[model samples]
Target chain A: MSAGALPPRVRIVEVGPRDGLQNECVALGIDDRLTLIDRLADAGLRDIEAGAFVSPKRVPNMAGSGELMQRLPRRAGVSYPCLVPNDTGLDAALAAGCTDIALFAAVSETFSQRNTACSIAESMDRLSAVARRALDAGVRVRGYLSCVIGCPYEGAVESRKVADMAARLIDMGCYEVSLGDTTGIGTPAQIAALIDTVAAQVAVTRLAGHFHDTWGMGAANVWAALQRGVTVFDASVGGLGGCPFAPGASGNVATEDLVYMLDGAGIETGIDLRALVDTARWISARLDRAPASRVARAFPPTPER
Target chain B: MSAGALPPRVRIVEVGPRDGLQNECVALGIDDRLTLIDRLADAGLRDIEAGAFVSPKRVPNMAGSGELMQRLPRRAGVSYPCLVPNDTGLDAALAAGCTDIALFAAVSETFSQRNTACSIAESMDRLSAVARRALDAGVRVRGYLSCVIGCPYEGAVESRKVADMAARLIDMGCYEVSLGDTTGIGTPAQIAALIDTVAAQVAVTRLAGHFHDTWGMGAANVWAALQRGVTVFDASVGGLGGCPFAPGASGNVATEDLVYMLDGAGIETGIDLRALVDTARWISARLDRAPASRVARAFPPTPER
Candidate 1:
């Protein structure tokens, strides 16, 4: 597709509070997490992933997600999607009064087994039941498919497998499916091929691009996906988090970088670039590290322009 | 254009020693610079820019370029191009027995005045004279037009001005014109528009993309240019250099990142990714900072992955 074929507007699903913080070395308290979500909302983000309801022992960084969710201010037009891996996590999200929830499954068998202690088929079985319960309760459910491109353990993942998994998620009542390059090992061509294969099984409009900047192909991969009519993306505020599988590797593509690119392309994202940059700096300072975003580094937060 | 329309092979002009080192804080001695160039050559980069022959007082980092040029190893098929700004710089390059030289002009008027103490027309006159002299001496001259996308002093540079400058350089006996995003403020759409406009004046085959990763759009911009049928790109090893005007900003796109992207896309760059990463680590160690490349950071030059 040509550059003119890019989506006119994109929905950015802010994943900083959930995916970003989960892999960070320093975990923020519930208050800081609330402020981050508020700041993100104030910056014009309507979809924000608040936190995951995983076991606190497994992910200490997300321990107070339930309490934080309970204390979260309800803003009209803004939805905070919390991740629910199973019935227990879904119950926690429900207890926190979450109306939007996300479920994740890995396409690669090794990643599926290692991350959730189940095979791909079993993980899908569990997620299908959870999606049923969430939809029955009137909660919107989104699906996340990891290792859509390549897996650290499995090397190369077949696009056919990813397509099958994505199709299954949609059949299970997911409103949208986010294809993740979990290891950040995908290039633009690989991203385009994956999107093409998956879009054949699921509507392109119902797909989102979840890319990591591990090899610095995150933005390029997003561009490739955009050319293929994928209109939603998942990004972290300050490019928070590192690949647990690859130490020192970058995590999600920074929301600020994504906004800068989309805005320059005349694509409306409804995000305030300067405000988002400020949020990036504020949170990175709290994390006691410089923001991993190239935009954040180029335009420093001090004496804001 | 579809991803299938991408070029089958690309020529990479490695500018780590010249453009990359010029803006870096640490100035390497001639010996270390020689080693860096050698390592890059060993990694399969044929078009390596060795250094610049400018005033030592202006750019102290390139003080020993004349001597460094004389000592550069002449590997079969490998060509070392040195930047020559004016008649004096041309004389220095000739004295060093350099056969390949590069001339630079800015598309932004204010940047031209500030960077070279001359107007755009005047800078062109100087470069024209230099190009004439180098061509008379049988030296191949390559042209560089900085701020092709945007400028620090002048916010938005007209694409017409960039096209005119690139065409003029080509007319002045320069074999190829490299369009540089000096401030690194361009998005992919802007890049595509600029390429389309400039390619109208100059053959797309005679053009190269030189991008900086200031806002993390370098790789995406490259992808945009690739779709436009421009195959040559200028990259720096380890993403050396910073925007001299924008203090904390990034400089050229990392060669490792570019090679990784190209390799994964099934595009031939003829460079070994592992060796390039190793060289990035080596040079970054000398500069006492981490390599500014996400690829380098993700695949640390550790126990050899």
Candidate 2:
């Protein structure tokens, strides 16, 4: 650590509109999801994950990502980010004319096999092409590493592997990488140690935390990461994402809750929590179930037309 | 700080058997609830909250608390604590032959009014009487102070007020005091500051953290409390409590999840996490909705019985 260097103020990447709601059985229209994004941008989030471009057959909730991105207001300060699983998804993202595309790879073999049907090396090899294509097209690329802390099947991932994989993503031309506790299996100490180890190999600012609340340690891990100099976090709005280890294993950390924490701490995330809550309600009503995020469930107010 | 003194270890007061299932809209039989408590004790939670001795009309979910207490297995090493809201509830718990009983008091005027239909001062006075009676009956008393950090009606509570409440509970001869973030508005810094202030007037061991995951900082707050030498935590089995203020607000952190983190950190929670998950599933199935606890929902084993 630099002597007396001021820690970088954390920036939260709101993934609620995208990764959060994507796995729900809910079927939200394109407009409602986009409005949610617009509200999030207006609320203060500079980087808002719009949606993921994927197969509706697999992720029906994310089927409207392309349309949602096109209709989005594209607020002056807000950056609309979308996820692309592989080269095919990246092509869809670029076709939609998104300048910023995110690629995902799992750190745990079990999760990678379950989510992508590939090994870690194989998944990265596929995402490398996506990153390269996006970079060539003059687009920004971010990397997501899932299950960096604990895997549902394997459990207690080694920190060294996480750091090595994060370094590899950076070397592959990704602008930033988010380390995810996909199963919500990390303690503050484990998170601090992972960040410390990964920071040794990559710039601390390039690393972010993607924590699930399965074990209710999502925000705690984020706090530990921030203390270790991580400045970026990925949170789902109303904690929309469900655990693919099967939904309900551990849900995503609700974006509203994360913003509340950041706002209370005097951190600069530029996100309006009230706006996020409105988005959560709109999508939740469509799903015919409650918003999975704890904060959205706690604070529900109708949005003004 | 004593150089050679070992840092204080946090204690897990599993509230699943009592608090978790008590507020559910569904009605569960007494034997099922007793079985749940027995399983929790087997999982190694030394302080297992057995049941709540309240009016059946008010909290129908807890109608059979007295019978549940009478039916649950008596383990020599474990303390089966039951919740007593007033003198009548205390007598009911004593009639059931419970050795340990807990008393409830809310800090927020609004919460106390809604929860007990009385002023905070009035509730405290009643709890004091119950505490005195419990002491005379040779029953251990644990005091609960809800809305310690923030309230739904009134936001941003004072730490000194929480300290004062803890002092009163202790002064009334309670063995320990549990401070709750009932509405889940507290952050890590705020929690640390609150615990530090409370610890100044009372012994740290006597203080416990009971945080709701409504805003996703429950576990983080618990971590903060752990750092402050608070060894006791009050957690529900399936994240089953709700905030009356914010309709549908999440309840306390899930017990299985807490056990996972504590176990991972080498903290001795004395819980067999797999067993806890089973109990959570069994209770949830009977409730007609899967347990709200993410960990339990994620890892439900098909209970053969």
lDDT of each candidate versus the true structure: 0.92, 0.78
- TM (chain A) per model: 0.97, 0.89
Question: After superposing candidate 2, which stretches have Cα over 4 Å from the reference?
Answer: A1-9, A16-18, A21-36, A51-73, A84-96, A108-137, A150-156, A243-251, A303-305, B1-9, B52-73, B85-95, B109-133, B152-155, B242-249, B300-305
Q: Given candidate 1, what's the lDDT at residue B16?
A: 94
Clashing residue pairs in candidate 1 are none
lDDT tens readout by residue for model 2, A1-305: 11123243568888877777776555677877876777776677789888898888988888878777777777676788899998788878887879898888888898899989999889988888888889999999999888888787887888889889999999989889999887676777778778888999999978888887776677777776776788788887767766344645545777777777776666766666787787777666666666666677667556467
Candidate 2 on B219-284: residue-level lDDT in tens?
777766776678788998777665334366667887877776676566776678888888777666
lDDT of 1 by residue, A3-104 (tens): 677778999999999999999888889999999999999999999999999999999999989999999998999999999999999999999999999999
**What are the RMSD figures for all models against the true structure?**
1.7, 4.3
Candidate 1 interface RMSD after superposing interface residues: 1.4
Q: What is the DockQ (computed on Cα atoms) for candidate 1?
A: 0.79
Cα displacement (Å) at residue B243, model 2: 10
- Give each model a TM-score: 0.98, 0.85
Candidate with the greatest TM-score versus the true structure: 1
